[model samples]
Target: MPSPPYPVNADGCHPDKGWTQRQAAAWLVQEESPTGEVGFVRSTAGFNGPLCEPLTVQVQFWRLTYRSAAGAQARGSTGSAPDYSFTMAAMKHVQLRVDGRRDVVVTPPKGYYSSHPSPCVGGLVAFYTGGPLTEKELPSRIVSGDSLLTFDSADFHTNRVIDSKLSSPSDPAVCDADGKPTRPTSAPSFPAGALLPTPSYPPIRLNPTHT
Candidate 1:
């Protein structure tokens, strides 16, 4: 499995926070892939269980342009909102990839929302606010494990955003582990919005086909 783009710190910083251009280049060459696809896979158990009731799946992709000491481009899911924003800062632009389509720059407010910079790092971030399942939507029970829940780029933006907010920023922050930002105790709240009709659940089975 591919690791998320963020670091593992609470605030998303690390020891090697500021890498020299040569270091960044070397790291990029060894650590990051230039192009890739990411998405969530519903677990067979979740689909069979009650937790799947309100959940929906979505996949997102962004064109990453890295700047600083070294510059490069890559394609992959932003993981979650904060992760999207964190990933965005290193890149010049982003294109939303959903349902097998490419080069879809999501229109903000309708498709997503750019949010306040995290207190730890002043990086710009964004999340999906629209959809049948807004951030407010909650599951009846909590599921766990690689088998219980899979989150990549393709799940509802709300889920992506919430997951990012809940995730350790250190997991994605460009800085090294010692220099990553401190994690936020309280997650940022979602803006007010109407709840769109929930997407219907796809066939519940082990390894259901994805677009």
Candidate 2:
């Protein structure tokens, strides 16, 4: 699998505590694609598990897939970008993917809010306010590597903002449901969102069809 666009710490925390708000603002500025190219960024989240139950978690996944007003003029396509936002109120987990190769996880600080910057000209933003989740709480598909998609490094660059509130670096150990530390035998698997609903545009396959 390809590495995430953002910097991931040993604890599987993207951005960790070193990333700052200023960095996030700067990253929000989209970079122009050379060949009128396009790419995508993704964010996933899960809920209704052991941590927070009874009530489902509400989430908003945003995507920008077209050229901005100014961007369209420069491209000479006379086309403006469209905003793609998906809201999931009740689900075990949700995975949002764009039309590119880069997969990103939007992780904020322990007590602060954070967003992920998209690698493509028009990117995706992930935002959610809920209790921190554990690996077991993540969707079964992601844990089993059924929905985890990998793409080429050159295809996308997932730029994410880091939280500056952290005083010390994060611990490398992956935490369990009870808040205990557990070392992984291999590379740690970050949290992933579940499948997306069918949209008007072409849908990216989250799970591979079995033969």
Candidate 3:
């Protein structure tokens, strides 16, 4: 199965937890396609009994295919231009509204906020980039955006911000009594207003899906 974009458990825990092909085969029924391709089969599938339920499931599919565990992703080099290259830029000073006060993280001029930046900020944000193209610096640029979404610090911090915002137990408006998100009244969102929720324990360290 394809990896989830969001967390699965109430604790912002992922049921898969970086399960490998062999490990996944232990929990799920593995099958070979007519073309000799290995995949998870829905019918007579293998899964842990009383499988942990998902807090939110987005875009369910009947079958999920993969070229390999991790598909091919191109990586570019530094200087001398190739067919494809990735330009690198460092973040200079940034301006934000902290608790309704205008706060700017400016250095002598174009310098990065080397300290830990706050997760929450509001109002105008000026992302000054592009200074001088050095091994570090680049030209000056600005990116402006309003609060796209908000999360409780606890919820936002859960699983490095990949946690679930909605309670795992079904919401009647979103699901039938059976616990399905048939018509969700409100989807999981970063806690918008005041409340900030934190995870109870330190989250587990997950391995990279690809070797």
Candidate 4:
């Protein structure tokens, strides 16, 4: 929402993408009712320390109209249709603020009518700012902590938990590279070069269910 020093000349008139040098100078100088009129100034300096050129604002009015159905008689008349309409008054004004200070009043020229309500019922006041000001103008960031209490604890516990009682020793389980059992493997094997134990069988018994 940043704005240039002056209103942009959409027709490629201003070279700096801002106010032209002449426009800036005119804004700096304050003038009375140059045409010997009153109510608003013709031109003035803007809040951004630049000139604001004179501008004309237009207002309009409207009314609602109604028509009866074709060939329909009027509500209280014989064989005649009736039409109705109503008028509403609305107004709009275009003005400039100088350096965000002072409201100069100007009188509209002949043909300007205030009694007839304008169709556009609102006022427009434009001011210049470097850009839209933000209430909270800061960037955001996030910080995180390590999951492990210590590097050694993470390294040792991770391997031990993986090797416990669920994997083969040769398959990266139960021991480190030197084949020492720092953790228990799912199945125990005879030590390297050691004889296998004699095989023994256990008795099995079934328990009755009491559902």
Candidate 5:
């Protein structure tokens, strides 16, 4: 985890409380799906170098809650009922790497307990190149692997492999255009395009004659 040069602000946090930005960033972990796409999770995420550098990040789903801990603890802890006053929103806040670090930040409403996220669910969140720093999108919710990415820069101490390199899933299977769960929540998009593969089909055995 890299030190985010800024504060990790939340409802119950104080100016004096919280870990060093590096420590907090470390608390954010990633669980790579069997396919090799990276899912980043930390209270606060940061990016270095220039904003002009092209980069695309996909946020599958997230929760924002004000709970009593240095970071979000998702297991063995049950959160209270949803309260709108204490907003636990999934936001992708970006600014120029050197110029306007403090220009953008969202302050959640006061009077909340800790980081227990909302029960509500939303679609994939993303920040694309050339878009406004404060603006983001939920282009598609389905997860796929149409490309392969490798981290070859010397800035990295060790080589890294990103198996399924996807810019953004062009078709959404779980979410809608606005990041909301679509109606008939269990149904798949019609026409059955390659981008939207059906999951319920029976498995096929290849090379059955080999034996």
Candidate 6:
């Protein structure tokens, strides 16, 4: 099984330790979804690099706590239970290279833990690229035909097929026509129009090694 970047607590809970600015930035990149489009108003305020860049990362652990009795029992509770939870780990910063793009060399960070991820680890790593526009913004692309690799691990290798991809906001201007102030619409929450497609590529495996 794969190991976590830092040892988890005895209760299998990830420590709530704070992360460095770079670490947090790396995590944000890893955490963003690989599908859909972000229409305009962007977050991830401080990062200024292109949407996609090589990532140096480590494994992170997460816990899912059941908030209701139905939720607890659905996971196979033996008896009536007020609450329940489960824990698992996932590797982040798994890099995906696009077709025809030049290769990138990403040095692994300290506390490197390389292994085939545990089967229990869930979700696809985020593949970042410039959103609909070229401004500094979060990744808004999907993994549709690229090769996913693991640079954080000691031995770099490749995973051939990405079985699945994991599957969010904004504001408006105050200007009006003819230099007249416009009134806000009474129904602020309406269905949005058809959206343009974000960049997409193929995927790879669970435990990535550099090829």
Q: Least accurate stretch of 10 residues (summed lDDT) in model 3?
A: 59-68
Clash numbers, per candidate: 36, 6, 13, 11, 7, 14
lDDT of 5 by residue, 95-196 (tens): 222111122222211211122211222112222222332212221122122224322111111111111222222222334323343434442322212112
Residue 183 local lDDT, model 6: 44
Each prediction's Cα lDDT score? 0.25, 0.23, 0.22, 0.24, 0.24, 0.23
All candidates: TM-score:
0.19, 0.17, 0.14, 0.16, 0.19, 0.17
**Across residues 65-115, which tens digit of lDDT does each residue of candidate 2 receive?**
111111112122433222111111111223332211233333321212113
Which is superior by TM-score, 3 or 4? 4
Steric clash count of candidate 1: 36
Q: Compared with the true structure, what per-residue lDDT tens digits does model 6 show for residues 36-85?
A: 21111122322222223333222211111111112222122333212211
Q: Give the TM-score of candidate 6.
A: 0.17
Residue-by-residue lDDT tens digits, candidate 4, 81-109: 22211111111122333332344544432
By TM-score, the best candidate is 1
Per-residue C-alpha lDDT of model 3 across residues 115-163, encoded as one tens digit per residue? 2211221111112111211221211211111123321111111111111
Candidate 5 or 2, higher TM-score: 5
**Model 4 worst lDDT run, 10 consecutive residues:** 159-168
For lDDT, candidate 1 versus 2, the one ahead is 1
How many residue-pair clashes does candidate 6 contain?
A: 14
| TM-score computed on alpha carbons, candidate 1 | 0.19
- lDDT-wise, the better of 1 and 6 is 1
